[model samples]
Target: MQLFIHQMNEEASNDILTWQYDRPYDFYNNERTDEALQEILDGSYYRMNDENNVLIGFFCIGANAKVPAGNEFGVYNEDLVDMGVGMNPTYVGKGNGFEFCMHVIRFIQEHYPNKAIRLTVATFNERAIHLYEKLGFVSEDKFQTLFAQFQTMIRREHQ
Candidate 1:
């Protein structure tokens, strides 16, 4: 699937806020609130669409992608390009993760060349963790928040 990343917009952001995932994955769900919409439009977030123009997911970089608690743990010490991603619930478990992630990685590389990429994920989400690992993201650090434990993974830029 071809992915096109664009500046976050209200319609796509609203649609993303309505996506519902099952059980544990529901932790990533967002409410259609003013604050939520504001967050997505905060400049750091980008909307991802497929070749067919369907919203496939979204990506957020920089400080917005880092869990606040990670600061206390010193997990964000490195100046890596941090990223947070969310796939549309409908596409979740459809074996599209690898391709989707590669597209995101390439996007980041183009925009931020020579920087290592970092991602923090809930430890419970083994599937995503596995996909990241397969993409050359190695386990870097682990930190716990009041609600969940997260593992930070990193993929160094190619020389």
Candidate 2:
């Protein structure tokens, strides 16, 4: 499936919440709601969309929620940021996830230079793990449960 990456606008933001509310991949089924979507659209939280001219899925990058202080992925530092992404079920397994992540990596790296950018993946999510690894994200010895996914921290190195 073809995907286009873009910054989240009001309409897309609403769609993201509506679609992600009960996402199978989301650890917390309650994470997505009209309020949460409004926060993203308001810019307190940031968002990105994997659009095929339509909303397939979206990502969130928030402040002060970077790398955790303790984790198994072995990354224990504060010079990083945390992000999460979710897609509409119709777009699952269609490479949109990987593409959205790659786009996010590029966006974060360019926007937050000299600081590490990080993401968490579930231990059981081999597909996501592989995708992050392929994108040059080194997996930390860290793991946690966010929603339902066994989270693994991945950090992007400075180029």
Candidate 3:
């Protein structure tokens, strides 16, 4: 499956903001708010599409990808590339994550060469954590937010 990455646009941003995941994962759902839209339009986020031009997901890097709560715990002290990802609800658990993630990883590697990568994921999301580990990310720190526990994982530049 070939994936194309594009700068986040209003249509794709609106589509992503409405994607509702089941239970637990629903925490990722967003309201169609002005602030949310601005974040995607600020140039930190990228939309991913399949060969047929179907929106598959979105990925964001830098500060936009960092969990705000993690700042208090110093979980993001390092100068690494932080990444956040969300897939269309319909694609969840359909076995396309590995490929989707690989594409994102490659994109980051090409754009931010030599920097380590970091990801913050909910601790209950074993499926996602396992996928990150398989992609060479190692558990670095764990922290708790008001709503959930999270683990910060990192894949060093050399990995």
Q: Compare the candidates by lDDT and give the number of the best one.
A: 3
Candidate closer to the true structure by TM-score (higher is better), 2 or 3 = 3
Could you give candidate 3's per-residue lDDT for residues 5-106 as a string of tens digits?
Answer: 999999999999999999878888899999989999999999999999999999999999988999999999989999999999989999989999888899
What are the lDDT figures for the candidates, one per model? 0.92, 0.61, 0.93
Off by over 4 Å in 2: 1-6, 20-34, 44-52, 64-77, 141-149
Looking at model 1, which ten-residue stretch has the lowest summed lDDT? 150-159
Q: How well is each residue in 1-159 modelled by candidate 2, as lDDT tens digits?
A: 455566668776666555543334554343567676666775534454333376666666754233343344554445576677666667677776767677767767787776666776666677777877777777765545443335446575643
Q: What are the clashing pairs of model 2?
A: 27-147, 27-148, 28-147, 72-141, 72-142, 73-140, 73-141, 73-142, 74-141, 122-150
Q: Between candidates 1 and 3, which one is better according to lDDT?
A: 3
Using alpha carbons, what is the TM-score of model 3?
Answer: 0.98
* Local accuracy of candidate 1 as per-residue lDDT tens digits, 32-145: 999988988999999889999999999998999999999999999999999999999889999988888888899899999999999999999999999999999999999999
Q: Would you estimate the TM-scores of all the predictions?
A: 0.96, 0.69, 0.98
Residue 116 displacement (Å), model 2: 1.8
